[model samples]
Target: MSFLVMDDGEYSFIWETLCDLQLIFHPKYSREGKIDHKELLGLNIKKVSVMLDRNLLSSLLKLTRDGYLKDEQEMRIIALLMTWMIMNNYPASAGLALKEYATKINDLIEPKRELREFNNIFDYYPSMMWLRLAEGAIDSIPVCPLPTEPFITEIKYNEDDDHLLMHIAEMLHVVYLCRRRELSPVEKMLDFLIWNYKYLLICESTLVYTAMLFTSQSGIKAPKNSGSNDIGKILVGCRNQAWDLNYLSNWSSFHYYEKTMDEIFMFATNDILLKRIFINTYTSGGVGALIEAVFSKSDSQKIFEVVNFNQRNRIKPDFGADPKIYLHQLIEQEKHRVMETISDRGNFNYH
Candidate 1:
């Protein structure tokens, strides 16, 4: 077979053009009245298709104003959306939430849902890798224009994400439409930012840490070990990169946090405890006391992971508890855990 390659710049333009075209012909998501097909049908349909994208764009803009985390249920959805939006430089992707940018604001929104049990959330949304925001991902915002491509990237109208995106977008629209008159841009944006939920840095850590807190002593890849180190690196790297100018600038509705890195350490330590407990319990205990033991050992990570991520093994789609949850939870949990631990060490001045 012959190999043909499309250049990055060329493919990007082509992809953008395709999406633009889809806005007209397919009209994937036209706003309330930007386009009346009846008006266009009387004339040439193809020629007037250019206006289709504008309507879709308007609709998305309006949707972003809505409250993502209305409650616990909405919090789960909001977390997933944050993960998806931030996984890529979604802010730059017209009419969509800037994942990394929104993440910072989401991060700032305290009392947020703890992702410690993200593994459990994974049961519903499989790719926990994208949701667990690393300190680096948030810190890296100043250096926007992500150096790497998105981890879980997808176009708006692709086969797998088409329905999901549309549904969520519509739901958000309904939310915004309700408060349209009362709230202005600044108010809506702030509301979206402070959408309060718990933040779980522990249970979200990787597998190596899964072995950390459970044992009396640390091990090969303990929170302070080799594997956890890599996890920390990725978390911080991703968070930092998210804020980098290479991705979105300060004005991109995505925050470029140049200040403190405090959360890094906090998230790391907690993630380690959570991962260890969840993996131990999610494996054999299969929703039993062992799960509580893991939680007991974890303190709050277990509960955070379960309630926020797993929804307490309530994830639908029947993926069943197995090695993936073990690995994914451990890996992601390890990610934040490592960063937090290393960050804590970095702040160590007394030693």
Candidate 2:
């Protein structure tokens, strides 16, 4: 049996579909769009650190300092810290540099332990009820015989890549929700967040600790024109960091750092898919409500079954005969479905 390599156009279509869904859901975001001010800022890195067990921070930092991370691993962990710093009072430049260093050190040495596999999702689990609900969503999607092409084929998707796979499934669900035309804006966001709550919380916690170290080493200041009077300086700094998408370095290592930072910041700030929900929650209700929602649980027996079936049966298919044609067809189907979703409303008013 032969395989078909996915082309640029295929990848572009998948990416664009994701982007279009995001914009359709969240129309207020732009590369230069402003973040609204909020009284309750993000988690306090230092305060959270002092309150938590010291061993947790020491163990992780030790592993990082020992150079145990893999490609994109450090970025994922450091992004949390960068967001923490931005939420606190860390200077945007300083946060950027810390993120860079975190990404650079993994190349220097091997680890005594394979830390990636050892990281437990349960350790970061939210409230018991919340866990059940998220697990339920996980169980809801129909598990097909693993298809070839477009999705994972020969290569087995593992825990590290589960987020990616789960996200694809989640996107399909979002499409399903849209087609039904029954979900409200906030409810849709809640569903998505709850389904991926573990990863989101881990990112948030990891970021808080990461930022704490940076703040301790090099104190951060607010950007110019961003003041107490401005009412949105912290958020503005985050937006500014997201906007500065260009690289400052010519070397490969540093360039990788810059590129990763740009991607993470852009996702954190402008990609309204998740961030907007978070921001809206924080601004209106407060962090406590946000935490509750992130950790809240509901029944998952149905979703769990769907997830279980897919995990066992789905087969990745080869679009080898006509990869581009298959992708175009996929795009058209989604377009038609989206139109059906908005038919009663008459039109999609995208700004």
Best candidate, TM-score-wise?
A: 2
Tens digits of lDDT, candidate 1, 1-351: 112233555335433432332221211122211223344334432221121111222222222333222233323333333342333222212212233333445432221112112212323332233232211122111111211223232332112122222222222222332224465433332232222112111121121222232322343121112332344334333333222211111121121221232110000001223323323323433333432443344543443454454454332333236534433443344344434544655642111
Native-to-model Cα distance after best TM-score fit, residue 265 in candidate 1, in Å: 33
Worst 10 residues of 1 by lDDT: 261-270
Output the number of the lDDT-best candidate.
2
Regions of candidate 2 where Cα sits further than 4 Å from its true position: 1-176, 183-298, 344-351
- Per residue, candidate 2 scores C-alpha lDDT tens digits across 168-198 of 2333333434344365433444444343342
